[model samples]
Target chain A: MKRSLLPFFAGTATGLANGLFGAGGGLLAVFLLNRCGIDKKSSHATALALTLPLSLISAIILFCWGTTLPLGALCIAILCGLPGAWLGTILLKKISPALLSRMFGIVMIVSAVRMFLR
Target chain B: MNLIALGIAGFFSGICASMGIGGGFVLMLYLTLLAGTPQKEAQLFNLCFFLPIAAFSLWRHRKNGLLCTSPIKPALLGGIPAALAGSLLAAFLPNAQIAKLFAIFLAIIGIKTVFARRESEQSKEERVIRPTQKQ
Candidate 1:
């Protein structure tokens, strides 16, 4: 396969997963981009960029399908999430790449187990 | 309904966003399993929750020169359709099936994570050894 096409394929797969599961696209993207020869931090950043469009498209689809959530809950969650995300980014900078990768793995495993048990 | 739970979910999701990963899963699971929201609805809510976080994280990453923009266009092109299709499928799928699939997805990611970590460790060891060997 052409190297240039790698992002396309990776995006499609991640998008599909994001659309279906409403999460984990960035996780998958990080892994794929890393394999495609990007550095760990860059992969993470790139994944974030890619995630925006994918989530937007998928969110719109779900919304149009009549998936309605409580307005108040949504408001509270966003309010908290913004700061949380900022904190995470700071932590990302302080942490070593190796440690970050490990954290990523731990999160994946924990998430998998949680989903399994649920 | 629980304000504390909502805050916790958002905070964690934000952290994940900063790491350039999607924390939407955490938000979705929290809402569905703990907060008593329906599965499909929880997913939708989670999506909305992360939009701002993703945008914020991306902007920061770009400003810091961490973001590699080269692959974004192709990714967007390929991802949009897939996302649409996946969304449509999830909308119609039964909750049980979606739950089962979610479990499978998590498990796969977990397994991959383990392997990825190992591979990274091994490569680091190689880089160290190769330099010493050339000395």
Candidate 2:
């Protein structure tokens, strides 16, 4: 198996984000997928599928470390999010890529800015 | 590097996951962009790595106060079979269209999460119907 330099850094970035901050790791995954030449759909689908479990693992470690969270809200959002993700996928079928990209760029910049500013 | 990567990934996976977000994106980025694994391989690795990690983590959280299991039954009743049905159909779909759609979806979530600022609303929305509401 050939190893490359970039993905290692990508993993480190995500791991650090998870261990310390606990946010934006999913977005980081998509950024990697898009940047690395993976088709967008696979990136998203795979990202969604992949995150489900990773989040579970992350939660476990944090609990052991004695972190606190408000579970009720997350469950509602996730319960809503599953259907929402599916619904969003349907709507995406009719949307334009250019529009998506413009919005995506704005969101990415905004999210990063929030993290940086905070 | 592998040890470091795995260690870091495990740490991040727990923290990000408890927040109700996926850490896959971060892991994928690490595998694909940082480690230089191809996109496909990175994605596969993510799913494989995810199942056990997530299940175990959820189990741990359920024991603590961070995770709950009471609501899973109703949701799974409808979700489980549908996921299977959808997966079977997704098998024959086209790639280009899928990629475009994925991009669009991400952009919207990115926008929503980025622009929304009211944490109060988020907190209120998460509270379940009180036991009294069941009647």
Candidate 3:
């Protein structure tokens, strides 16, 4: 791929995944941004910056398409998440991302198995 | 799950999300597998839940000088239309099928995450100039 086109292509894939799954776009963004030669910290931050608009667009489309959003749950989550976000930023320096990633990966695998069996 | 449980899950998921570590996945899993939310609905919920958090995070990152604007324009150009197309495709798919596909995606990501090395362990040489710096 041409160097200039990398971000565009990365964005395409990230947007598609976010729209399709309603999640996971940031993961794709971070990975692709890193591949684009960005530093890890910037990759994470830049991925968020990139995905924010994509997610907004996706959410709007999903809403217009008549997906019944759990508004109450959404509100609760956001309300509680604000402080949690702060805590997470603090923990980011203290915690080992490698360990957290492994643990999170395990949870994802278990959840996938459960979903498959259901 | 009860409201309290949901709130607790939200709190923890928020922490992970802000950390840029796929907290949305954690919330989605909890909603679908534990809280009995439908796959599509859970996805929608996740999207909505993430918006505000992402905005806030972006603000902080910008203040901290972690943001790079050079890639954002091209990325958004490709992302906006693609997001619309993907949403349409998702909307047309049946719930069960979406669930199956989501499971597969989760599995793939899980495997990748498990095998991936920590960024801190990477050599300093991999850190390149910010795209903006090249301008």
Docking class of 2: incorrect
**Candidate 2 Cα deviation (angstroms), residue B85:** 3.4
Model 3, stretches more than 4 Å misplaced?
A93-96, B120-135
Residue range A1-118, candidate 2, lDDT tens digits: 1224434444443333332223344555444433343434334333333344333444444444333333442333234333333333433333422344444446444434332332
All candidates: TM-score of chain A = 0.86, 0.65, 0.86
Per-residue lDDT tens digits of candidate 1, residues A1-118?
A: 7889998999999899989988778888988887666777788878888888888888898898888868898888899988888787676666644455556666766766776676
User: Candidates ranked by lDDT, best first?
Assistant: 3, 1, 2
lDDT of 3 by residue, B1-135 (tens): 578888988898888777777878878888888899987888889988988888877777677777878999999999999999988888899989888888888888788878776676554434554454667
Candidate 2: tens digits of C-alpha lDDT, residues B2-103: 645645654454333332244444454454345655333333344434444445444443443333232233323433343333322222334333223334
B1-135 per-residue lDDT for model 1 (tens digits)? 789978987888788776865577677767766777777888788878878888888777777788888888988889999999888899999876787788788778767765665556757877888788678
TM-score per candidate: 0.89, 0.43, 0.90
Stretches of candidate 2 exceeding 4 Å from the true structure: A1-118, B1-11, B32-40, B94-97, B121-135
RMSD of each: 3.6, 18.5, 3.9
Off by over 4 Å in 1: A97-114, B118-135
Considering only the true interface residues, what is the Cα RMSD of candidate 2 after superposition?
Answer: 16.4
Q: What is the interface RMSD of candidate 3, in Å?
A: 1.5
User: Arrange candidates by TM-score, highest first: which order?
Assistant: 3, 1, 2
**DockQ for each model:** 0.68, 0.04, 0.69
**Candidate 1 chain A weakest ten by summed lDDT:** A95-104
Ranked by DockQ, top first: 3, 1, 2
